[model samples]
Target: MKKLGRLEFFWAILIVITLFNTFLGEQFASTALVSVLVSITVMYKGLVVIDYFMELKHANKNLRWLMRLYFIIFPSMIIATVFF
Candidate 1:
């Protein structure tokens, strides 16, 4: 895995995400989905950008973890919707 350059690594991940979404939308479109479909896609893209482009793993440690709270709210809302 380390042998793969960063761009190659991200490309591989992109392929996997594409395959997953294609499979998911076909299999479960009529079923109760767990997440907002847009968020699902944005999650994958954000992760790639953070890891490959931003190089967050290598940079300073002061990550604004608070920003992630917005992402968490989606699943929480989904659960809330199911419960009440």
Candidate 2:
């Protein structure tokens, strides 16, 4: 057995989250709970990609914040659209 590096670990987590998202989408009806769960998962996935996959965890503060802000705002927008 070999050890997984940082990127590999994050990649694996993203894969798992993708699977969970798919299962959630397929196994349930469109309701507020489902929508909120999906949105939260989406935000987590986005942050993982932005911070780990994108190699922005140690980058410029402003640039990192800008990308992170997108993940936050977009997922919030999705939840908002679901309600109103």
Candidate 3:
């Protein structure tokens, strides 16, 4: 197990992303598409944070399943609701 938290790595990636976003903002209109991509990146970074920062890797299998379920089930439910 890693002794150190993953915050440093997360912070670095967040900084890089922020810098890229700043660059984009300067040259681009910061449209909805760019916002969506940024949100996706944030979500991905969040998963890493959950695994390492929260030490979810050492947690019980059931809890892990529930967490995973939230990611899939919640979003699917929202989409289904919209379609139905």
Number of the predicted model whose TM-score against the real structure is largest: 2
Task: List pairs with backbone clashes in candidate 3.
Answer: none
Candidate 3 lDDT tens digits, 1-84 = 345445676668767877876776688775665655555555555566656666686788787667755655544443444344
Writing each residue's lDDT as its tens digit, candidate 2 over 16-82 gives 9889988989999888888888899999999998887787989988989999999999999879978
TM-score of each: 0.51, 0.88, 0.51
Q: Quick one: ranking by lDDT, best first?
A: 2, 3, 1
Q: After superposition, how far is residue 80 of candidate 2 from its true place, in Å?
A: 0.8
Each model's lDDT: 0.59, 0.87, 0.62
Deviation in Å, model 2, residue 50 alpha carbon = 1.0
Write down the RMSD of all candidates, one decimal each.
4.1, 2.2, 5.2
Q: What's the lDDT for candidate 2?
A: 0.87
How displaced is residue 20 in candidate 1, in Å?
A: 1.8
Each candidate: how many clashes?
A: 0, 0, 0
